[model samples]
Target: MTNKIDLDFLRVTHLRGPNIWTYRPVIEVVIDLGTLEEAPSDKIPGLYERLVAWLPGLVVHRCGVGEHGGFLERLREGTWAGHILEHVVLELQNLAGMKTGFGKTRGVGQHGIYKMAFRTRDEHVGRAALAAGRELLRAAIADLPFDLATHVEALRELVDEHCLGPSTAHIVEAATERRIPALRLTDGNLVQLGHGAAQRRIWTAETDRTSAIAESIASDKDLTKSMLAACGIPVPEGALVRSADEAWDEAQDIGLPVVLKPYDGNHGRGVSLNLVTEEDVRAAYELASRKGDSSSVIVERFITGDEHRILVVGKHVVAVARGESLWVVGDGVSDIIALVDSQINTDPRRGSGEDAPLNALAPQHGAEIILELQRQGLTAYSVPLAGQKVLIQPNGNVAHDVTDRIHPSVAHAAALAARVVGLDIAGVDLVCEDISRPLDEQRGAVIEVNASPGLLAHLKPAEGPPRPVGKAIIAHLFEDGEHGRIPLVGITGTLGTSLIARLVGCLVSLTGAQVGVASGQGLYLNQRQVAAGDCTGWDAGQRLLINRTLTTAVFESNARRILAEGLAYDKCQVGIVTDVEGAAGLAEFYIHDADGVASVVRTQVDVILPHGTAVLNAEIDAVAEMAALCDGQVIFYAADADHPRLLAQRAAGQRSVFVRDGAIVLGDGAHEQVLLALAALKPTTASWPTSVLAAVAAAWALDVEPTILAAGLRTFDAAATASKRA
Candidate 1:
């Protein structure tokens, strides 16, 4: 009809876990690039220049050539629209503040049909980026104007809405660095780290170990102060007052300069500092009382010094941030509000977003700022003379890192304050003349003990280097040498994988651990079927790993599942491959032979933990070839004890499981042990010698005792398991 190019999305799938593409969550979109399939970038006038001009970050995308400016090289040489779309989507996401680098595009055997995938932290954001990328690419191809800023802003809104907050993400990143798997428990910040019984849950800065009573005590400022005072930790003298009159009376009783705030408040909201007059104190009381559900306000002596926040994790002070009073130097033309906008809010670190280290200041919008202005005999509209200084905020922007300058005694007081309040992780707010000097020497005091404190200030400090507060919190949750992982086994193959998984599950359960099995037969938790009918995919595996009562887990996957959904867990203690035999239902995925199946099946071995083991069937040449792909130890299994691969594995000082006469044998190079007789196994396993050998190898890798392995095999009932699922 015309020379116009067009693209139609055929399908979009969110691969939530590892897949054939990679070991991360990716959004895969199948597109039909109608006429654009023939229109390579080099053939399209101004297309390459337009794209590079809009997304200059695309030059860093190594793409297929695997070097800087590789994507640009491909575009200049000649490339299809689908490949260009992949890079565009990734660049869009990067500009939207979610940095991800992995992407791929390939033809689907059809003339114009192609599949494109890119890594994303959130699926919703990924889909939004895809839609925007498609529109932008089409507009560029048609030589039409596209508003890149509007699209980037929309994608950024989606990122803020769907992605984890910076604090939670920092903690999750730390956990990932330690090889601890994390699962988001909610759409919000609630997340679970580790697997099954070893897992710990965190919501932002708070963890499962944070006590309800401790949080309650921290919320009540008066009680927290009293407790700190009693524990010999210096605390501000404060009293709760009910009415505005009572607030002034308490302030007078305390002294001329006083601090008034809500009895239970956070984030410095509804707080007035350094009040010397009854008018200011009474007005501050009304502002403070309106903040929280409480009507009472606290009147305390104003400790004259810079405000400081010390982060305490366990018994150690991990990070410290100092707050400086905000001031504006008048240029003689701008009012207070205009000055705040031009001087304070204009700082790149200040914004309304969670990623911003400091919040933008607006005197007109904040009650505390308005009250502070009133005390200074000024309002938001007041303009000072040139070079004259006006204090806009007296306190409460604790974002300059002072951790290295904090005195040891001050650090101890903060840690002790947190301990006194009974919080495993806390932010202790204090005021002192100098952080390098002790608090007692400067008449400084612990003003508040805050539970679930904000971590942004320490993580992205305005002045000093960012602190590892997230790592400190993670370390408090998990000790050294503990990754918060339980023993896990993953089985993948085309034959007898379900049975092997179930057998291994049963064997591990004999050690008094509650084992969960997700296999083709069904999903079993401690031998009880929780779900039935082919539970050998990512979702079922996730259920097992997330179950709080599960002490150990076994998962079964086939070549098809590996190609389609990826393994559920990140790594496993034992990965078993029975035989890479079948390619029957994989034609849809373009996998038509055992070699293709072998490549898919090797994903199981590829994910084995370095300290873990891979149990391979030495009988199958394809499966035996994957032993070298394992990052961990290998245990070859076969029906014949003298199988050459098994003998070689044994000679290499590795483990092997095989059948010798009528007995199952376990050998480690020079030593051999008869674990049990084949006659001792249940009748159901009599014709499943290979499956039995695979199961025995996996169980041995998991450190199941020889005696327990024998007993579990003798008692395992396939009929009962199937009936239970039924």
Candidate 2:
């Protein structure tokens, strides 16, 4: 029998090539879910027809439905099949057209095809796409095996008897959102008040879970300062003050030469310094009051020093910008107003539709200038006796020239400040004359601290974009084995779904760690769950969503789409954890050479792949079943002996592997295009369990040594310990 078939990705490889099927036909669908207003015509009956008709393969046999049956089994495995994936399938109709209220709801709509589509696209988009796609697919696939028929009937009978759904939340979610058949009861003729899960998934950790991360953030001034103090860093003497009255009292105690600011403020706002005269103090109070209603002001002894912002991540201080806010630097020709304009204009974050630097405060005034020059006993116009090393407070805010001076002590203090806060990432704001000087002797103080500091600052910030900083961070975040990050592969989509749960389960199990789940962005981002798209969204949060920007933003529900595309970039020397099709998983690392072409490195992918994958796909089932037969990480059964798939394609690869791992190369000259004598086993049980994985990831993050780590991983009995606790 001659039958046409398309390639469903068995093992990951480069884009389009020959298929495994001898005569099996291909199935394809095209669609646009971005637009949806009308419902469908027919339901399940029509859906089956549309799907089979469009499929390129001949109808071999019809797989009928049943609970825990082979059809569902095949469908689950189908996700790994690599065919061109689509977000929606307008070409097909929903199976048994989903049943609904007296009015029929379109059965399953586009999601039926989407289940497999994510897998297809994950494979097609290559590694980067797959990494993201795999995460998205995990989230999307949770909709299956809809409300059970028997359960729906039981629910309906209960509704009729009680005239009210079950008291618990689950019944409400089933009755309303699932639109499970409900008998309309006359509650003195009141409306039906049933509900469904507020959302299908809640991937966020609890309030306490998030609070820990915030503590390390600059959002809490007490924590920030405490951390710096722990590091034995020097700063102007300061204390957190609660009420305006406390601030006033403290400011008085601080006397005239003091700075009052919000304890947890950043970006140079809510700050007032150099109240040399009473007018400046009053204006400063007004600014502080305007900053916020819950404005907890900071009272500190202001030192006669220069200010600097030192960027640090882990043990490294990425960049140091000599302290300069818009106010201090001057153009000898331009007036203070013009000089302010020039400075603000150059600041991309500040100038473009942002609060101007000096609407309420001035960078340089007659008294300030005279004071700066007077300290040298001169005036602004006083020719500084041929570069008399004049010290300008705001004057130090020039374009950073770290090549000149960054005292080792200041760098040490900045790193200490970040460490004190118990954060792996931070930016230390400093006020110092010359970094080379001793902390006590230097006329400087740590002005502020930043958490999740902007990557832009470390790049070629206008003046440069913190590109190098980003590179360093990206490297550390995705570095392989110990001495690096615990590869964090974010899997989101219509997130909050089963895949997230499964992937989380899989990752924690493999790494032998606790599910170290943390929420991204803020409470707002967490509450909404899935980040939806713009324009006519059902909810208001959609309207204000950061949405997808070219910079560090998750696309509007399109993270799935991007993950689908990024599949190929998964190639790495260490380890990777992308889907059979390539997409996002590993963090993105960029390498730019003379061509200025930035090649994003996706690595440490092994962390994402689950243990039981062998039980799924037909091909992998066999290979994973015969684990001893497979040798090395990249055991491809390619078309030729000379080149494995990736090598034959001549693709450029990168290094990745978030935590500790064994490095292996595929398609080398000595071992190209060959099946291994002993296959690697696909895991049935975790080498390490969840808590162990977490411990390992944490240990890797802290750069624990291999011998120590292996001993720890070996000694850690996550399964037994967890079971015992349970």
Candidate 3:
């Protein structure tokens, strides 16, 4: 939580073996907190840790850049070094501050980001830091000393005076100036400002194509009824009853066995079922009437039949589950005390953190049980007869409590319900005895839907066995097209909105693949339309799209479009959306409705972006992280001299090429060179452009054979030209 930033977080050493280390020039960082000065050789705390862990096989600087007298000094000499330094600086800026949410937010800062990173640097790091950082930033926003407008002015002043570094301070200035709220990340990746941050929660191939999941559509039971009606889902005739009397009135018309529950509640809360009489109806209605402030209550006919939760995220159906009728097994030998204790410990209430097993439906008690036991010729203290199964009616105080042993059909229903709710990740609740039966059975009903489903109950397993529901959630939400088969060569850009259609076309032509241009327009294009387009919109218009997708040369237009989608979906797999991060007059449409509904919406037109000036004010490292999102082998082309920074960062990860001539040449040296290689692509394998000569020379020193290197240089001349012609 400290405001002062650490500067010596540098000194990356490339690791090749157990003990061997090699040095690549690295850009170092030194925060000169003049007042909090340190001795000349003060070893930074987390700096050495990063070097030891993250740079295991990659090249790193021997002498870290240091801080002197309140300023980071001694910028590195090589293009690679400067690029790496800039990356660290931008991270520090996020550490120092950057607005949370999508890139469109106003400020830079997140909460408690540093704490988790300090805890783990490996797999647990990114998601942990992102979760905490955003939370911290979301909270800090309301308590800012001055307005966002005022903060921006101050940040600008700080940058103009060089008080803050160019890449990081500029972020503070940008976020503040824009009024989107910002936070500078500190150690552990803490969001230094704001609260309730919502960013980086999505990064996947399935769903989330347009960022539509984050936005919530609001409505009451009436809205639910309407949506169901439109989707043509079978629904029992019902009305929104605001009061117990109205509920009873509505229930009367619908006959016996009614159900009452909240209109906007998630999970299985505030609901009552199997009420057959006027008295039963009154109790259920009263309970539902005490709804949460953010929700509403509804009374309706409780259909007698089997139910299923069908979940569809984007385009894929994730899971389905059948609700089981609630029942408690009797050990016959154990006292009620042991039974209740054992059950409550199963799948406990929400946020209670304590596992509540028997407590799920309704915790058993001595008082209520005495009556039932007496009827069975036994008292609470008396041992139950062997092999006896007790069915307890949920009087106002109790309801179906156990969902841990649900039927497979119920699981299927849960997935279906998630799909029905239009969320990539969701949980559905069904109340039924025989899950495998058809949904029209007279003993089951679908209760509610949850957008973010938790499977702790299924995980710990209250009863028979444990299910990997959590893993299923991960798969449903994260898994993309079959990884090994897709062969997606991701292309990125800083100004991709300006070149999306062309980029796709270029890729298709180069790979001898096919395009899905019409898919973005809502058309389920066959192989026919993909080959028919002129490749116009796919060319320059997606500058905004590719950048946000991976930011090789992204533009603002693409950033805005993705942000506007709110969340991604699985359906985008075959869709060809473009110009994200850009604003169109209307919102970019996503496949949210069912297949029947979606078919009517898609027409496959080229995406258009709002025009704007290009902005390239981000730190190199930030851009590199964006590039890594491509998640595929990609070829980066750049003439602008700034794109190669992506290559340097990407080098640690995938098979990304620094394209110049027809043949690929490994790029080394400075950030500037990396940028140049990524940006320029007239697609000509021209006269041995010495532009890559310096990098080639560095490779020669690294022991690459001179003859092979020379041949590489020669190959680009003809290959690049041939690529251009193609």
Tell me, by TM-score, which candidate is best. Answer: 1
TM-score of each: 0.96, 0.37, 0.37
Give the worst 10-residue stretch by lDDT in candidate 3: 16-25
- What TM-score should be assigned to candidate 2? 0.37
What is each predicted model's overall lDDT from 0 to 1?
A: 0.89, 0.35, 0.34
Pairs of residues clashing in candidate 1: none
Model 1 residue 706 lDDT score: 96
Backbone collisions counted per model:
0, 103, 188
lDDT of 1: 0.89
- In candidate 3, position 264 carries an lDDT of 67
Q: Pick the candidate with the highest lDDT.
A: 1
lDDT of 3 by residue, 152-219 (tens): 33333333332323223322333333322222233222222111111122221122332254214212
* Candidates by lDDT, descending order: 1, 2, 3
User: Candidate 2 lDDT, tens digit per residue, 1-726?
Assistant: 012212222223321111111011112222222211122212112333333333322132123333333232333334221121221111111111111111001111333222122222111222333333233222233222223234334433333333321111222233333332121223321222211111111111011112356543567666666666666676667666765566556667767676766666666556666655444544455565556345567777787756666777677776776545433354345544444445453455443211221122233453343343444454545433322344434433333536236677678777777666655666677776667786778656776677645333333333532325433443333333222112222222222222222323333334333222222221112122332222111122122221221011111111222222332111111121112332233222111231111011111222123311111111222222232221223222211223323343234341111211221122333332211111121232133222122223223322334445444333333222122111
Instruction: Show where candidate 1 strays beyond 4 Å.
Output: 1-3, 108-110, 331-333, 383-388, 722-726
